[model samples]
Target chain A: MNPNGQNAETRDGCAAKLDVCGLDLYYADFQALKNIDFRLARHEVAALIGPSGCGKSTFIRVLNRMNDLIPSCRVSGKVMLDGEDIYGAMDVTELRSRVGMVFQKPNPFAMSVFDNVAYGKRMRGLRDKRQLAEVVEVSLTKAALWDEVKDRLKKSALSLSGGQQQRLCIARSIAMQPEIILMDEPTSALDPIATGRIEELIGELKKDYSIIIVTHAMHQASRVSDRTAFFLLGELIEFGDTREVFTNPVDKRTEDYISGRFG
Target chain B: MKKRVFLDGLLYGIMALSLCGVIAVLGYILVYIFRQAAGSLSFGFIFRSAREGGILPMVVTTLYVVVVSIAISLPVGIGTAVFLTEYSGNSSLVRILRVAIETLAGIPSIIYGLFGLLMFCRFLGFGQSIIAGAFTLSIMILPVIIRTTEEALKSVPVSFREGSLSLGTTKSQTIFHVVLPSALGGIVTSAILAIGRVVGESAPVLLTVGLSRNIPRTVFESGRTLTIHLYYLTNEAVNPDDFGIAFATAGTLVMVVVAINTLTKILTRKFKNSQGDAS
Candidate 1:
């Protein structure tokens, strides 16, 4: 939390969409995240920037309990989404529906393009065909991929280019109407052109959804996010507005990382 | 360098000789069977009743055991595999089940024959019928289905599971929509292997499946499979014609296996194409 309490205060004076306090995660005996306090207001893109194994990916996964898949993973902390304890009271499936995620790799289900986008709604029991079609269209259009895929919605999603596949993943996330979308290095596997397209998509996505992206590229965080949090060796080194964090980091480690010094 | 080259040439010659030995034995059996079966390899011999020098009843019984055994085992085997791969995480029960499956696969067919005779035929009172034999064969093939399906499930990428779960699909739904579909090719291969085992086993069939020569109208009726009929014919051959019929039965079993192999390959290709569209 900032000294001025601005981090917790939203423009609308509502509770922060996400308020994470005193979070410490462990995998068996090995701690993966140190005590960290964070808060996210509505419609803000908060980018997590760190080197490899610095827990940026792990932190984003914490938001949706994706780490629950790991048998050894253990988490302690208050991860409250809209003032509800996600780890305590909310059902895992319900929590995930409200907090969508895009992985580091574009993992479109092995199905038709239309089916990939409609998977979430279908699983949630929306059996009406017209409703599903409408959701798919709206989601794809929001993800900035409708024009490229509208004609070939029946084609296999695997048939798309790597960049298009990433967009399709974003569209898949959007179809669920999640309040927050956590992206774990969503474009790290793509070419520069694809990465640029995703960056632009992230900018447009923040208008409707709270976006938290984990990226190894500092330039990407500087370019895409409104707030940037720098992590170092499982500890959060700095958290502030993206422009200020890039221009004048309070922590020495954050300055060293952003200045292209050793990570 | 010259000596190493000579050794390499010598090793290659030995491998080539071994390959030829395998091909020679296979070719010799096929040619000898075709020659000996010349008198009985007709359409009538295959389609007529046993009293009329045909093996139609045996063929029908063989198919019954194959179909019924597969139907009984495929789901159970796949379920065991899913439990091992998806739900049971590093538990000793999974390890024990794996070891049990491995041991069962190595057990002698005669032991299964005796067990089936006691359990299904006498105790359960199904009494030396097609159902009894199918039940016995289904148990015999469970290890094959479980092992192959386990491998198939493990081979599907972890990312697929994560992707599905992230969409708020339950574990079972993720399995149904992504994991199993991704592993469909392997599951089909396991079923084919189980079919191979069901078609080839004669000792167990002889114990549970009776030596009835008539076509079975129901699973409760006593019947003989093609392998069992071939065994009986070979054991009681008193004339050249009898020997001819025995060899013809062997030839027919081979034909059936080949036909099934071709049929499944075509069906699996179609299934793969359909899965791409529907999933």
Candidate 2:
């Protein structure tokens, strides 16, 4: 046991897979994310729950430097992966490959199912058809979509149902074999049954890959996350075990939010 | 409410009338040209040289000019559009470039003919050749290609770009692999429109490529395009007995334009269908 009355083996067994320290982000003159300190251990699922426009989405984009595509966006803090500052030392492409992202909308490329799954590998210069096929099958299996789409690998990805398309997106990210996956409201566009399947998939995924999910549903946060962080007005109001954050929040704002008092 | 309903009906009727007016004008011209030229429509008139009872040399020259001009303009125009839409920052320079492009699109083709005559024919000593005419037509059509291609590229959803970038692909790769393929239908439509303009142009071809009756053997050889042939037949009254030939040439030109327009519609429809199936 550690002096903080926590199990040292659980707390420090593995170093943080991704850490954001004193992170501040802005879009032109509008401050989107205030100073933030967050960490995710390997094989753990961290859920960021907040009301709309509270910077949860922006914070996740900061992880992969996806915000770099926005001309007016800027960041002034250290985003560390394996203790090395991603912004300062890591190449953007390398960082993105290491930290894959799934957007709110299921954005399967206008391509065949096989091509969609094989795109990342192709981008990384893999040309062997056998290798690409192996990666695609493995990824789709991991995303739990292989059984549904195995017969129609050559069909257009957009032909699939909405939920299936979302899983294909997950398979696409998984094919890259990233250490972390950032999902921004990935299930918001899904039906309840589809959302349940994704939640179950997230449970299975946390055994191998760290996940940082930003969701609007409070119940979803409590159901899927090991650790939950509450954001309010671009601030991290509380960060702790999911049970404690939901049942006994330290901040009055966090308490009011979890109990559905106000956003 | 009754007044508003009446106004709405009036506006709709006016729009319908305007559409009918456009279709009537187009249909009337087609009928007139077909009726006048039907008597002279013969295989020999189509295949024989201009010196013979045909306008085949002029047809060949027009084709040459269209091919060479499109070859020159397609790559450069599409490149400019890609740079403008994807790479160009929203700086003052970009603003100036956009304004300049719009201004170029509005310039008269006669001015382009003069410039081509001075630059390609006299100064460069490629005097009154098919190549000079091709270069002039390329410059005249460049703005059309660029503007249309830029619009097409812009219509590609930003989400597609984001999806590609998130997969760690470079911007150039994303553009070449995804954006360009998606915009190809529009780009081809633009090229066909430019070709239509090139085929119909008379003043510019007349100034750059002289109204010679013989088929051009090389880029540097003088030739006469169909439009220039029509102009000569009309103005010089080359043979009062061969008025049917003039009408036949006019009919062929109109047919070519109509063919190109039909091709544009077909290509766009095919692309839209494929895109629909994909997404």
Best by DockQ: 1
Best by lDDT: 1
Error in Å for residue A174 of model 2: 1.7
Model 1, B1-279: lDDT tens digits are: 999999999999999999999999999999998888987898888899888878999989998988898999999999999989999987887788789899999999878889999999999999999999999999999999999999999999999999999988899999998899889889999999999999999899999998998999999999999998888888999988889999999988988887887898899887666765623
Q: DockQ of each model against the real complex? A: 0.59, 0.40
How would the docking of model 2 be graded? Answer: acceptable
* Residue B194 shift from truth in candidate 2, angstroms: 1.9
DockQ of 1: 0.59
For model 2, which pairs clash? none
lDDT of 2 by residue, A1-263 (tens): 12122223236634677778899999999999999988887787899998899999999999988999889999998888998898886788888888988889998987789888898888889999899999999999999999999998878888999999999999999999999999999999999999999999999898779899999999999999988999988899898889889989999999988888887
Best by TM-score: 1
C-alpha RMSD for every candidate: 3.3, 3.5
- Badly placed stretches (over 4 Å) of model 1 are A1-8, A11-14, B1-39
For candidate 1, give the docking quality class from DockQ: medium
lDDT of 2 by residue, B98-138 (tens): 89989998999999999999999999999999999999989
Q: Worst lDDT window (10 residues) for model 2 chain B? A: B270-279
